[model samples]
Target chain A: MLLPYLLLGAILFVLGLIGFVTRRNLIIMFLCTEMMFQGIILNLVAFGRYPLKGAPTFDGQVFALFLIAVAAAEAALALALVVLLYRYQGTLDANAYRMLKDE
Target chain B: MPPHPISLSALLPELILLVAGCAVLLLGVATTAHRRRLAPWVTLLALVTAVVVVLFEVLITGRATRPPAAGSGLFYGSLATFVRIAALELGVLLVLVNWSAGREEERGEFLALLLFALTGLLLVAPADNLWLLFLAVELVSIPTYVLVVLSRSNAAALEAGTKYFYLGALSAAVFAYGLSFLYGVSGTASLAATTRAVVLALRDPNSLQGGLAMVGIVLSLGGLLFKIAAVPLHFYVADVYQGASSPVAGLLGFVPKLAGLIAIFKIIALTGFWDTENRAVYWLLWLLAVASMTVGNVLALRQTNIKRLLAYSGVAHAGYMLVGVLAGPLAGKALATDGVSILGNGPAAVLFYIVIYGLANLGAFAVLGLLRTRGGPCETLRDVAGLLRREPGLALLLALAMFTLMGLPPTPGFWGKFALFGSALTASRLTGDTWLIVLVIIAVLNSALAAAYYLRVIAAVLLYENDQPAYAAPREAQSIGALLCGFLILIFTFYPSGLMRAGQHATRELSEPRATAARTESPVASAVDPPFASP
Candidate 1:
């Protein structure tokens, strides 16, 4: 019974990883990371609700809460960086900022 | 259950950093005109105070035979004290370096962000729970992303911040995903409890629980490899280091990297993952060490840009540190015998190497910051040419730092590399493992390869002639900090025993309890089940 929920969470995680790697737009890439966070949150909540044995514990749920908080902080920073990049380069494309590379 | 009174003294250094950081932020707004002059002093005062507090903590711990009363909750052990003190001392140096090098406009924000990051680093050492560990890691990372952009408003700075943020975020997610799996299998977030659970699960290699725990370890560590700038995750380093201002780049080089190493060490200690029967983990770290050294050094050899060169060198250093990690007891079958432990030596070597590397790297970057042209900070090998003629003192300081990085004798870098490679050799001897001897050989060759590039920079400073006039002299504050770092490097080189003693103390404090815990737990597990003998 717990297997399906775990499998679903794993699928979401892999999907998020794929999206993050394949997507070129900076904002989209960040959103994909968020998607990955969501998947982790799902797994945490699922595990909290159903233990492998005995009664359910709140450890996983508490962890998921902290994860959400940290993820929010990360998102805020990511957006600010994105805005800074756009203001400087006038594009959200990752390839647009290559001034640091070696010739 | 009766509520436990929280020990505020345990959190003294971090609390000081937090209050000072917030105060600096407020001061930035209230006294804008005076901030450029006032902020750095305040930051320095806060850092000094925190350092004093850490020293006091260390002293008290040293005198006491019993475990510290304050060691129970968030803060635990002398390792925490040592790591915190080391990190805060580096923070003070960074503040001094950044004081004059950072633009006047962002002085307040710069100091404040740096303190916030230090607070995160300070929290990382003593974090008992995975939740706190994750939070501390983020706290360290987020402010750095902002600081990367705050150093300059140039396109490169912004791009560096963006690239750093994206990769950092991805790594954090990967870490979180791994943690969730760990939580699912272990059913707890406390590292001690989770370790027990993970060991039990791993006793059955074919079980679903065992498979999940292995996945969790890989995924979590895989994410952390970004901070260390190991291969496959080091692609962003050169660009980021080059984009950020030199002082910020120096902070980038050490702060997060040190925090990550300590955090990883804590995880390994708590999870006892190194001592597990899992040879896969050992092989994985071995592969990473070899790859990072080869890739970092070889790529570094061709780099014209000094920042890129240092960035790759930083990668290579991380590889060297990984060799120390690989030498740890986790990789082998040897456990405690006659209570004379070899387990802590690997971590001790790493700690010692970090202090040496931090001093040298920060000094080098400080010199780079000092040698700025009207165009901007010196970025290429050619820029440093004729430095010997224009500024002999700065040229010599840079040369000392370069030689230290190359691990030449009479410099602290030589001692650091010796200890690291020596520990690996010891571990190999203990385990009768030939792979570690091979690792030591690879590391030695890589250091030689690294010398080729480090020498090139040194040669440029001393040999090449430039008729162009000297750029503006470095600011007094930065020159002083650089000199102090150079002096410390020289002093530590001649008197290396003190640093080695402290490193051994920190490592012993970290591993002793775990050793005892394993000893007590193993007997019970072994008596009940013949197949599940604890290593």
Candidate 2:
């Protein structure tokens, strides 16, 4: 019963990681991180039902709830930063900001 | 399966900071100009109050033992007091470092956000639940991403903030993913319970639970690597450090790294991997330590920008602390051997090193923050040339900081590195792990190599001849802050015993219950509690 949900969670996590690494757009990369969070939250909730050891506890669900709140807070901060970056560069390209190099 | 009890009194400092942070935000947002001016002072007031509360707790809590179920609850005594006071003390230095960092309008937001972040850092030491730890760690960082941008108004600052936010979010997700697995392995979120689970799993050498724990730990470390700016996720360090103003750069160097180290200790101690001996976890930490040290030092060699140079140096410092983490706490063994319990306490050395490192780094940045070029801060090494002639007092302090960073004697940094690496030597002898000895030797060599760049900073200030960058509008606080850090370094160098004792008491049975402390009397207790932390 838990197999499909865990599989989906794993797939989403891998996909988000790929998107995060491969994407050039800053907003998209940020979104990819959020997607990864969603996957982790799903996995956490599923684990609450079918713990890997001993008797199950609702702690996984509790963890997922805290994680969701944190993710939302992170999203707010990420979007604000993206807006600031866009204002400075007039584009969302991650590579555009080269002002902080070693030279 | 009773619920772990929570201790609200142990959580007092955080509560004060939370209320004060909100008050500061409200004051900063008030329509009156005077109310806005009150924000920074409010933060200061809050910090002082929190420090008092923490000290009081230290007095009252006195080697306070946790309930047997505290493995799943917050640790309320020694370790909490150690980290909380350290965070607050250094936090005040951080605040002074940035007294006039950005425009006046940004000061309130900056100080308020800093208070919130400190609140999070204080929570990490006592956090016995994985979920609580994850939240606390995030709380420490999310505001800093904004604080970095608020530190300056330049396009570079904005860009730095953007990159910092993205990476921080990604790392948080990765860290949470790992936490989920840790929960699965134990079917509980309690750190001690997880360690117990790991102990149970290790009973069966071939168990998948052990393998699963390893996977969880690796991924979690992957996420946390961003905090310490370890090798794998250290790409953001130089850029973020270079982009932010010096005061914020100093803040970045110390606070997040401390949080990461504490959390790593908790998780590793959770698995009892250090004691039980897990090959995959062991070697992973080894690689991270070696790689971070090598990469941070090699890359720093070519950087001309001072902030960028310090940025790389910060990474290398993290690598050094990682060595201590890898060594784990050996105070128990040292007591059995020679009565010098401080000798082998790896975590104690780490605590001492961080305090010394934070002061030196903060002092250097405070000195830098006192002057600004047209491009912002004393950017290139050339800007520092003949600074000794132009500003003897400030230049001398910067030189002193560099000496500390180089771990030279007459500075506490020497003892910091000596104690840190000495613990590794102790670990090797106890474990009969010869590779640990090799690792310590390599770390010593890295310190030697680190001196070359640190010398360059001193040489620029004292040796080279060029027009020194004209001091920006002098802020007395920055100079005073720099001198204060330098003074503390000198004091610690002379009277190291006081702080060293604190580090020892703070580390003893830090993660384990009284049951574990009692077991330490036997020389082979390590045979029971043996390894901690991955690698």
Interface RMSD of each: 9.3, 9.9
Highest-lDDT candidate: 2
lDDT of each: 0.79, 0.80
Interface DockQ of candidate 2: 0.53
User: Which run of 10 residues does model 2 chain B get worst, by summed lDDT?
Assistant: B518-527
Poorly placed runs, candidate 2 (over 4 Å): B1-7, B60-72, B202-206, B331-340, B511-535
Tens-digit lDDT track for model 2 on B426-452? 888888899988899889899989888
| TM-scores for the candidates | 0.93, 0.93
The candidates score, on chain A by TM-score, as follows 0.94, 0.91
Clashes by residue pair, model 1: B274-B330, B275-B330
Cα lDDT of candidate 2 equals 0.80
Residues B1-535, model 1: lDDT tens digits: 1213347766777899999998888776665586557878889999999898777755865531223332132545667767777898888889988886446666777789999999998888777567778889889999998898888767788788888888999998888887787777866665666677777876776899888888887888888899889987999999899988888888997889988898778655644655653577778889999999999999999999888999999999999999887777432224434333333367777888988888898899889988866566787898888889888998999999999999998898998888788778877776788998999999999999999999999999899998862353548888888888899999998998787777766666455445433322321111222231221
Residue-level error in angstroms, candidate 2, position A24: 1.0
Where is model 1 chain B poorest over a 10-residue stretch in terms of lDDT? B519-528
Model 1 global lDDT (CA atoms, 0 to 1): 0.79
